[model samples]
Target: MSLIPVDEALARLLGDVERLRTEYVALPDALGRVLAEPVTALRTHPPFDASAMDGYAVRASDIATVPTVLTVIGESAAGRRFIGHVDDGQAVRIFTGAPMPDGADTILIQENAERAGDMITAMEVVAKGRHIRGAGLDFRQGEPLLEPGRRIDPAALALIAAADLTQVPVVRRPRVGIIATGDELVEPGRLRTDDQIVASNNFGIAGIVHEGGGEPVDFGIVPDDEFAIGETLDRAMAGGCDIVVTLGGASVGDHDLTAKVFAAKSIDLAFWKIAMRPGKPIMAGRRGDTRFLGLPGNPVSAMVCAHLFLRPLVARMLGTSTTTNIWRARLATPMAANEQRQDYVRAIARNVPDGIVVEPMSVQDSSMLKSLAMANALILRPPHAPAASKGDVCDIVVLRHIT
Candidate 1:
């Protein structure tokens, strides 16, 4: 069978996926959730004309000339409003955010007005409606506060609360079930034999799921047995997991039982063996309502695949419009030609005056987790690409979401 192209495989994996059901959650609990409904203003902001600065509210005609004296009849501060009008030769002491008094069309900033007991003298001419915020200036009633599919951030939460919303409708988070399979694998912190290694892929995958706004459920490690794998798969499905991810046991080895177990369960296999290095053994399929994804056990491969595939899948499920942060950068070192499989070379990126410069790590082994951790980006090398020299432009996907 031909290996599926990377782009084609991803397209197939995300086929027909829609946003999860919407649920109303309290404003405090809505952070990082994708909005499912548009939030509209419940009431107008600045309900009445308000003062934008601490000053004297006066008629524009009265303050048309500098050094004009007027009697201060009353004071307005924020919540309090001056009921009396500002007729000719009259002024009201108004602080910032205070409602504008009746018949006051202009404001003379405190710096431009001198006060003497119940009297203020304008020091400078002021324009009409100056230093005053009109009613509904920020937002009006019935106006859209935020659109659907917007991820609620800190500022978004504040805006929603200011809109008089106690609750917001957001897409339900997708639940991802992760299963680790390998007889030679043991849980971290447990005593393991020299030949055994700790099961670490599941934790990394789980973190990716969480970062992508999905709830990750670990199924623990199942020994390399068909029955054990089948039992764990059944439990994950019965537990209402939307996506099931299995680590290891995907290759055509005697110990590999993931394919057999999933096949026994009659999973509708979409594709397997993507045209990419380190993650070529990836398996994708759909079973009932839950999607199945089999990832290679190599530490770096699992994470790279998650970055390329799983993150976007979870974002799609949450109805968030997420795209890979791919950017162009100048190569800091020479690179050999790529073969049939596309390569994701771990690299370090630095912002230079000209543009971003990326330096690929000397070691490109798939088992090196340290290199992957230190890499902030992955340089993309397409199949059959020509050899590249230093200072050549290359495409890269940023790993960290730096603000």
Candidate 2:
């Protein structure tokens, strides 16, 4: 009858979270995936000490005087090394990324040199290791280049490639199956009476699962009959879904049969009825390989709970650190006194004179989605919170990541 405490609810919801086994995947398919193993360098970067610029490799001592003259020994371009050692009064013409000649320790820019019939003369002096990328400049063979749980990006992929990795071991994407229930709910484009609501929450939840890095498969909407819900759950399990999310009928009521259905399916109950507004009726459990999440009937409640619990579950299964840290901003307007429960108030953040301030949307109803679209963040209110003045720093959950 009362709201659950946020901390206790989080602990209970997170208790069953576990990572899946790892598998080797090609680099191209590895983007956005969490690494399952530490990525160690297979070979030294800049395998051979090489130039970092188009210049002439010369001994620093040989360019001690103004307009110093040195005979060009040979040319060095990328992948074309001039293995000849440099002698006194001699330089090697080298291009960017080219391996420096053996005896040369410094480089003089071509702009600082004058070409004279197969001979280039040094004009300015340089120091040792200058304009040169020494061996292991980026990474060394046998060194840990990336740790497990690191999310792969373009830069990371490039680094892996440079490490001579044709593929990488990564956590598998969580397969999330969505089942929407409610006789009044229908799919988009379907003819519906005024009493019948469009079954949009399931699709939206599926999309949210994808945004959270899980693969979502929609099982469509089912009538409020016990057999229909059971059938959908069966289909979800047969589809090899790691998690089955049932929309609506999660609370205690005549029509709320999701929890019963999940129980009948022999799911080990995790937790239900969190101490959070808009989504207090959320339920979680597990049936063998299938995890179950029963969301509230309210649309906004489903989304908020998805962000709070479902997203983290996916991240855990994928072996990535998960937390909605969008950077806290101040509240633009004073807030009302909160009840004994955590609240995720949908609000829009605007760049006002003070700073980036979040103002709660006028419509904070559980069923409203219009206000959700206009909101940039969800401001979190601690349980039994008191009314606060403007400029109170608060935690926010962004629909998108910034950094």
Candidate 3:
């Protein structure tokens, strides 16, 4: 009904949110998914003491002195280990990842040894266990390696695989239905009258949803008609969307019918009109299990709202941390004071010698998509803050990595 602070709005949106259902997926499909359960090692890594280099495995005492000749007893390669033992003054030709032969405590790399027939001369002294990977060097069987709520990245996937886990329990990706509402908006590349503009918010919102680890279902564009918007909302709810994102028609205007349609569906409006610039008209609600977010029609406003609200919502649903990328930076130029609403000024962030310096774009109109695209950070100005001069440090939400 009334405007609320951005932090308060976010708290309401995710205060009681719970993680989605868990599903077991193969390791290959687990990337980017949050683990719903801890992953334990099924088998010990390296199973046994293995050589880490391609050379001779001998007793460290035997190679304590250089230029020592030792009789080669056997050869050990990956998967095919030498079954014999290496007695004193004896060595075993070993390859990387090969199990070290019994009685061998170190490896003399081939580069540091000269082999002639069945004998090899150690050219350099190698420490005991120098090139040998001890049993369970990485992890032991039944040891917990990955904890719950951990997102499966490339390294996590590899770790799971190395732990002998073929399948992993991960939070199911939340299904997000994205709808664009406006009669003046048309699909991209479609024929449009001078009064109509191409729809772009849905695509950007969908990308944000995906980047947040949610599956985005595009409901296409709906006209300003209440029935059309209501029908789309019904379909999204029926389709079991965990979250429904409506692009545009959030403000109370003649053509704004999204909120009306949501009301007809008995959606419990959480809060509307946050005390923030660029996205002041944003609204959030929920009906049954499907949460709804009505973002401003302006492209930049919708995107910023998505980053601030939608991203955290998805992360919460995935049982992961909802930390944002806010950082501190010094202002590169002077900035005017703000009013009651907090300002998110899109700007270019540069890595200067001292620290990160942000220069606000000259024009910060919410409707300008080009400026939003060119921005790598958003300077956060609190409500009713005083004007700031150059070099004043301020908190910023980093949109892109500062280079």
Candidate 4:
């Protein structure tokens, strides 16, 4: 089969994806989860007219003139109301958040008033309805506090709490089953032979899944045997995983049996071998309701592919809008021309006076994890593009903050 373009492959992968089921979670647990239903206020905030400052509640007509004397009736503190009316030439001493006295429409701040025993003199011309929070000032009952598809962040959580909502309906997080293949790979910090290398792709892919709001389930390592790979795929499917990702064994090598296992499990292959560097051998397919992705063995390639595909897949499953943080940046150094495949050059981005300036790393080998770790951005170069100068502007996908 021919290699698929990046855009076409991604479009096909996310075309008919449906959102997961909705579940209710506590307000505190709803952080970072996408809302499945609108959050409406349970009750009106500031159920009654309250004081916004520590002052005396008086009639607007009474404080219209400066230096007017008024008798102090009673005090209104938070959770305690005066209950009596403020007649003409009378005021009620009130603290912040206290219910306003009946017949009182204005507040005379204490800074502008002088108190002597039971009498207080207004020193300034106070405006009507000043320093008072009217009923339902924040929000009214039955009003929509947040819309569906909104991700609950810190501010959203506070707003929900203030609206008296104890729990919220949010889309369930997608469960991703990650399996690492190849006999040459061994778990980190474990004993291995001289020819074996530590397995690291699964950890990076799991991190990417978590950051994208999905729950990752590590299925451990599978050898080069076709039976082992097929059995692991069956187990993942039976475990109710929404997405199954296998690290390594995606290329056309003798030991590459992941694709064969996928075929044996009756998976409908969408496309394989994308027209992108470092991740050309990537494969995507689907078995029943579980999406399948076979990523390259190289650490950098696996991470880059996961960011490009898995992140957006999770977002689609959560019923949230998918957006990429791609920004334009000036090149700080010259770059050679590209070939038939598109290139994602790892680079460092810095904020300059004019705008963002990006400098591509000298070494961009797909197996180099150190360079990938140090990179905060990826300069996107189209297929068959010409060489670029030091000051040419290019699109960059932001990975993290430079600092």
lDDT of each: 0.91, 0.85, 0.93, 0.93
By descending TM-score, how would the candidates be arranged?
Answer: 4, 3, 1, 2
Tens-digit lDDT string for candidate 2 (1-403): 3456756666666676789989899878888888999999989997988888898999988877767778888999998888689999898899999998989998898899999886776767677678888998888899998998888888999899999998899988899999889989988898999999877798779888887778999898889988889988998899999999999999999999998888788888777788888799988888787788899989999988888888888888887766665667898899998987789999887666656778888889999988876677898888878987898887777764322
Better of 2 and 3 by TM-score: 3
lDDT of 3: 0.93
lDDT tens per residue, model 4, 270-321: 8889999879999999977899999999999999999999999999999987
Alpha-carbon runs more than 4 Å astray in model 2: 1-3, 351-355, 401-403
Stretches of model 3 off by over 4 angstroms after superposition: 64-66
Regions of model 4 farther than 4 Å from truth: none
Taking every candidate in turn, the Cα RMSD to the unseen true structure, in Å, is: 1.6, 2.2, 1.3, 1.2
- Per-residue lDDT of candidate 1, residues 60-143 (tens digit): 999777788999999999987888777889999999999999989989999988888998889999999999899999898899
Query: Could you tell me the lDDT of residue 352 within candidate 2?
Result: 62
Q: Give one digit per residue, the lDDT tens place, for model 3 in 17-76.
A: 999998999889898989999999999997999988899899999988888999998899
TM-score (C-alpha) between model 1 and the true structure: 0.96
TM-score of 2: 0.93
- Deviation of model 4 at 396, angstroms: 0.6
Candidate 1 Cα misplacement greater than 4 A, ranges: 401-403
